[model samples]
Target: MHHTTPPNTQLPFAQACENNQAPILAVLQTALQSSRHVLEIGSGTGQHSVYFAPRLPQLTWQTSDLTDNHPGIQAWHAAQTAPNLRAPLEFDLATSAWPTPADQPGFDAVFTSNTCHIVAWPLVQRMFELVGTHLPASGVFAIYGPFNYGGRFTSDSNQAFDAWLRQRDARSGLRDFEAVVALAKLHGMQLQRDEAMPANNRTLVFRKSLSQ
Candidate 1:
């Protein structure tokens, strides 16, 4: 999830994905205990979908990302296919029209890692907007990445990372946790957990309001 590789890699890989998948899975096993289906946004190289689907055998894992990332994802899927893991869907938060509730009503949980800091802010808002619209009452949404708190970085490493990200794209940098929670609130979601992750990262979990 740190970088997007070219499609022609035949078998794209990300060490960060490998290092973090286990810890992420441990958190997910509990967070998504009752979830029967999950929609994975930004499936980068598809490493997470493959790793998570087989382990969380109770749920069907739906992978999605921009079309350019599909070949790498498909290649990974071909190498380690899971019956519960569906193929990747072409999804772009900035441009793709999200599936209607009738078309994707069964997705009870959503997951995305290392995406918020890379995409522009408006797209990030779109992601929460679509998730808020599509997710049913009590649906679970989990996002993993470095986030700022109270308008400040959590650690020097995160500060440096944010600098690096901004250097690459002026619009892309770590987001404020408060702003994220506020956005989620607008979408009828409430924060359920804020877990500390390795390498100065965090995993935030939100639950859609039942009143929705």
Candidate 2:
């Protein structure tokens, strides 16, 4: 049998999480200024959610991912003491029933980091679509990851990374920023900012435009 599964560590750690969290939080501070409720998709390892929730006391941070990731996420949630940080919700954007937030108007922000390239393209489309449905007017969506522009790689390193990802899983690789923005537009979201992040990554912020 082939070893297809990633190693299981109780407190599963990710160096990328530690390195990028501070920078990402800084951007979130400004992006989510008026926001209250935030739904974080692909809350892998529960690291980013736990790290960010306490700092942003004004917003309630919700963490969610596939069922297999729940135990590790719960471990992190248990360790954290912030009241605003919520327990992980077992969710799949493409397959889930499209659950709405408990509050009336819906979530004010949705955040996902380093997820698009790993999932299949159809699911990536679904993520953009479903985020549109969950967000209230003026809601913010912040996606952090490396992406190609004009269908060209930003750096040779990103090119290499993309190749490695595809070798690991044929469907996995960097997505074009233009294509992603087009998808966001179709769902009533408008690009508000595109800030460069460390390690050649970017944090793209979009705000919901439809009012109804």
Structural similarity to truth (TM-score) of each candidate: 0.93, 0.92
RMSD of each: 2.6, 3.3
| Tens-digit per-residue lDDT, 1-212, candidate 1 | 34545466658888788889988998899999999889999999889999999999999899999999998889899999899888888889989886433444478899999999999999999999999998889999999999999999999999999999999999999999999999999999999999988898999999999998
After TM-score superposition, the amount by which residue 63's alpha carbon in candidate 2 deviates from its true location, in angstroms, is 0.4
- Please write out the lDDT profile of model 2 over residues 87-206, one tens digit for every residue: 877788668966565653467899999899988899899998898877888889999999999999999999999999999888889999999999999998999999999888999999
Tell me model 2's lDDT, rounded to 2 decimals. Answer: 0.87
Over 4 Å off in model 1, which ranges?
1-9, 100-105
Q: Rate the local accuracy (lDDT) of all candidates.
A: 0.90, 0.87
Q: How far off is residue 72 in model 2, in Å?
A: 0.8
Top candidate on lDDT is: 1
Ten-residue region with minimum lDDT total, candidate 2: 1-10
